[model samples]
Every structure is written in structure tokens, then in C-alpha cells.
Target: MRKPVLTIFYQYNPWQSTIGGIQSLINTFIKFAPDTFSIRLVGTGADNGQVVGQWHESELLGRPIQFFPLFTLLDDNVRKLVPTTVRYTAALLSKTLQSDFMHFHRIEPTLAARGWLGDKTLFVHNDIPQQMSSAKGAKTILWQQFPQLYFWLERQLMEQFDQVLSCNSASTKFYQQNYPSMVNRIMDVRNAVDTSCFKPLAPGPYQQAKQQLLDRLRLKPSTRLLLFAGRLHPQKDPLLLLRALAATPPESDIHLLVAGDGDLKSEVEQAIEQHNISSRVTLLGAVPKEEMVTLYQVSDVFVLSSRYEGLPIAMLESLACGTPVVTTDCGQGPSLLTSESGLVVSQREPQSLAQALVTVVDNPQRFTPEACMQAVSPHSAQHVVEPIYNSMLQRWHVSQANS
Candidate 1:
């Protein structure tokens, strides 16, 4: 049988920013997508104004991948407005019309190309309008001032997609309540982890791994390791984690390992200095994805103090590594966590987060590594991807028969 063509549309290049959850999902999809499908990735390359309207061939998952650089044709003004959805849609329409199935990782492109999206699937990673409202500075003011217009436009664009795949229950519920007519189109396809790579180490290997990390960082074995991985941005609220760390007892031998960098790096550093917890924290800025599993294995607990999220991959990765998480109730954290794997604080305040961290660290046995690993089995890459791929193929077949 001839393979169906699957065209994926995303705004940014995963190769360029390999740090985010969205990028990880796109990479995972490309890595594990069935061989029966011919894959093409449509995204923006570096805006060097050199590679626009070009098709570049590469290998992903041992299969051929054709990449279309749509942003090369976009001018600076248009690129600035790319976040608005309409501009990139126009760019993608000409290139994406030939695929058997179209999958979009971002909403703006999906909204722009709605007319040609009869077989398209829109993957909702976050609440769009809410994110806009929560955005910093002038953008937030604009979104707040014209809430109805923004939501109306968003609803119209979302309704056009044949299938809407949400990564969390919170997003599914938001769309169902806001757009009742389109409830049937929404499907919950949660985020997943690679269990094979992130599985817990045996006692001997685990102890050695912990010791190696401690030796490298020059910390004693008795010192507890707390990890915070991801962007050091306002949305991630890295400062809150710093405050919480400062609030922990000064005598406690707790140390924090920060593994990512962003625009908020200077601010985070300033706050670290302000809090006088510099000695207790080390910034191992922007570690590679392969190293993340090792960090998780060595750590006592992973912490995320985000203001909002859809479903963070770091939380899932930590659980898969059999390391418990202590996070604020954000995104799908509340839905994915249980007493066995992690603790979820109700408030985003430093005091609440600190208390939860101290409690989890003090009684590490309460959340067993084996239980943490087991809880994430359902969210393995194989389990999540197979069903979604099958469903997409089935939908494509139905659409073809009707046409």
C-alpha cells in the first residue's frame, strides 16, 4: 500500500530551540511516527532571508523528511506580527495544501490556513486567549482591552479544524465550556515521556549516578538536591522557587540545580544574590536533553513554580526517572500527580511551596521511586503516539471516501 503523507506545521524550528516541551513533542512525533506515512515538516528556519520557499530533505526516525522553510519569505514587519496568527497562515497555505493530513503545533498558523484545513488537526498546547491576557506589557493591555474580539477570532479559527487535540484536561474543559458547538471535535491526547530512557536506575547504578553528580558539583552525599529545569522566565516564576528555597531552614543541607537559561537569567541571579542563597544554588545553564535524565536520576526532587502551563514535559520526565516532583498546581500537574509520585501545592506562594518541598524532602519514602515510575507508564511515547496516529489515519480515510 502507498503511504499517506503527513504534513506537520509548527512556528519554530525544533533543531534551533530544543529546550521546550512543544519542541520535544514535535521531535518525539517525528521520531516515532509510523513508517507507513511519508513525513514533511513545515516550519520557519533562521530568518537570514536566504532559504525562503525552499524544500530541504533530512532524515528523522530513519525515514525521509522534507522541510519547508516558510519564514524565509516573510519580511521583518510580517515576522514581528507572526505571533498574531494571520501572517504565517498566508505563508503556509501555499506549501501545506498537498498533504494527506495536516497537523499544526501552534494555533496561529492553523487559524490563518483554516480554509484549507478540512483534514487538519490543531494541537492545543495552551489556553490561547488566557495566555495572551497573562502576557507581559503592552500585549497584555491590548488583549485585556479587546477580550471579546480576541476570543471571537480564536473561536472561529478553532472551529474550522477537523480535529482539535488537547494535551490536558484543563484545556479540553476550557474549550468545551467556551465553545459548546465544537465540543465533539476536541480530543484529549495528553503529553508523554520516553520510558526507556527515563526509567529508574537500580540501586547500585542509582547510587553511583548520585555520587558522580555530587562529586562534580562538590556537594556532600548528605546534602539534598532540588532541581528546576526549563526557561528562567516570568511565566515560569523562577524567582518564586528562589524565595521558597530561601525560606527553607538555613541549617538544612538543601541545594538547587538550575538547568536552563532565558531572558530572566539576570533577574534570577539578582534575586539569588538578594535572597543570599547563592551558596545553596548552582546554575548549570542550558543542559542538553540527553543530560536531563541523568540530572533527574541524581536529584532528590524536581520543582516547577510556573504561573501557568498546559502540561510540562519536565514534570513527566522527572516522574519517569523515578524522582518525585514538588510543584504548584499548574497546567496538568494536578491531573498527572498523585501522592505516590509528587506533591502539588494549592497556592503559588513561596511559603506554601517551601512547606511542600520541605515535607517531601523530609519524608522521601512517602513517594517511592518505583511508584513514581509506574504512574507514568500510561504516558509512555508508544502508548500516546500509536492511538493518535491510528485515529488520524482513520479520519483521513473517512475524509477520502467522502470526497
Candidate 2:
């Protein structure tokens, strides 16, 4: 009768890879607890508005979603006329009005809303400002120039939340240790993987297309493939992967496949060319979500040398596909994954990464689909998320009774 005490956020869309992990969880949560609760999503734009098989706001597993503009003030107005602090305040007020329980997946807007959204759950996915504070030379200087306003704002917001979810233990400790006042509300909810969709590829479209890709490349009969899929950016540290690949033996019978696009696509291409590893490396720009299963099936290992990540969706997909993975120990997730099903290299080290790649490529049998599946089984939507939804509803009921 009380409409199950609504859950909502200004972030989530099935099509946007930036928040794909969060979107997947929301879709699954809806499926697992549809009878008891309903979720409304508010974000920048509508995923269904686009052509070319755009993902519905809540289209996964046949769920429906509602969306609205998240920012109250237009960017143009904020940039040209109003001061940042004032504009940010207006945006926060608008977003707080939009949702009952707010999940701030990114930092900028979350920091802007500091100490405002009373009695709302605030989940900070990462300490982006703190991470940026440690950046090199020019970047570090730029971050320090702001007099740590964003960092202070983030702390203030954390203090205000009724509940906080950290994606990994490291980040959980980050907020707890840094802002001890928030320790009580912090919860550790690692990113969940969509096991049904991402599991081992069936012998259908993915297989057929993969054969065509291999034939087109004139790839040898027994070549091991390494894959990297995500935005092309310095934060991902893709250039490190390039340098690492070039150091390997030219005739190692291994190849690297990069799938996705971003501003640094040109730079990555140039790095591949400069290394003269053109034959061994291929970049497939921005493959759609439906096609990712095929990409994983056609590959041997998935590598992510990111300098930072909360928990990469691609890593989970690759593991689900029965493909092995090699990633740098940049964030908490990689270390948690390394011993169970993949390799974890040190951050920003080309030689260490190259060695790990070679190791995985040589011993493909070391990694199995079952181990990967077991690792991610706990994080599956049905297993971990249903309770969260039920608890949220129960908590809301309790709050009302007390009131």
C-alpha cells in the first residue's frame, strides 16, 4: 500500500558503458524483487531515444525504466554566467528532489551536493578526487590548485548519508579511515556480474562471426589471443599494454585484440604502429554490447592494465566467457580476482605486464571457466542483490513506524 518505499538515482542506463555495472545491477534488482519494490532511474538522457538497437532504460530482462534530466542548471549557463558553487548547489537540489535514495556513481556532482540530501543513502563508487590528487607533475599541480575543495566536499557529503556503499574493501577502508565518522554506515557491495548473458558463448552468431574475423586476419590455426575492451584513455593506461606487447617475441603466436573507442584511439593506433606490432595487434573500435560475447569467445585472455578502476565490467564478462585475464593490481578488484582466476600485474610496468601476458598465453589451460564462474557466483544479481532490495524496503517501513 505504501508503494514499497521507492529507490531511485540520477544515474543508470543500459546502453552507457560508463555506468554499465550499476545499470546491470539495477536491472537485476528489479527482476529479483519486482513484486515488492519498483525503481525509477534519472540520468543525462534516454538510451531508447537513439536508433541502432539502443538499450532501454530498464530493458534488460524485460524491465521498464523512467528517466529525467539530472542536472538542474544547463552546462552553458554554469560555465558562462553563474559561479560553480552556486550552479552546483542548484543541481544538487534538483537531483535530491528527483530521488528518495540517491546513488552518486561519480564524484563531481556528489561533492557538489555535500551535506544536503538528508536521510538518503549515498554510494561513492571511487575516490576520484583523492586519486587525482596523486597524479603526476602537471596533473597533481592542477588538482592541488583548487585548495582541495572537492575532497573537503566529498568528506562532508559522506558525513550526511544514512548509508554508504563502497565497491571494494580498499575504498571501504578509504572512507572509514579518512572520515571515521562515516564508518558506521559503510557497506561493501562488490560489482555483480550478469552470469546468464555473459556465460560461455553458444555455437551460434558469435562463433560464426569470430571465424570470419580470424579468416580475415589470416591468423594462424593455433594463435592465442589477448583482449582489451573499454574506453581508450590514459587513466586506463593502455599505452603501457602497447609497450609491453612490443617487448614480446615477434613469433610468439599470440595476438592482442582491442575493442572500444575514445579520444585516445589515435594515440593507441600510433603506439601500435611505432612498436611495429601492427600484425600482432588489432583494434576493433566500439563493438556493441550484443557483440561482446563473440569478442570474448574469439579471444584467449582479457587484459586490463588500468591505472584505476572501481571494478571493470569487462573483467567479469571475460571470466564469464571462460577466457583468462591479466590485469594490473591498480584497484581492489584485480587483487581479489588474481589468485582465483587471473593474473594481476603491478601498475605502470610494461615488462611485468608483458611477462604476465606471455605466461597466460603459454599456459591457457591454467585458467578455467568454472573457477571464474565460482569467483563471480556470489556477485550474481539473484544471489547478492535481492536481499539489499528487501532490506531497503524493510528499513523504510521501520523509519515510517518510528516517525
Per-residue error at 287 for model 1, in Å? 2.0
lDDT of 1 by residue, 7-26 (tens): 88775564453456776788
For model 1 the TM-score comes to 0.88
lDDT of 1 at 269: 94
Whole-model Cα lDDT per candidate?
Answer: 0.78, 0.64
Q: TM-scores, in order shown?
A: 0.88, 0.82
In model 2, state the lDDT of residue 38: 48
Counted clashes in each candidate structure = 0, 0
Give the Å shift of residue 133 in candidate 1: 5.1
Index of the highest-TM-score prediction: 1
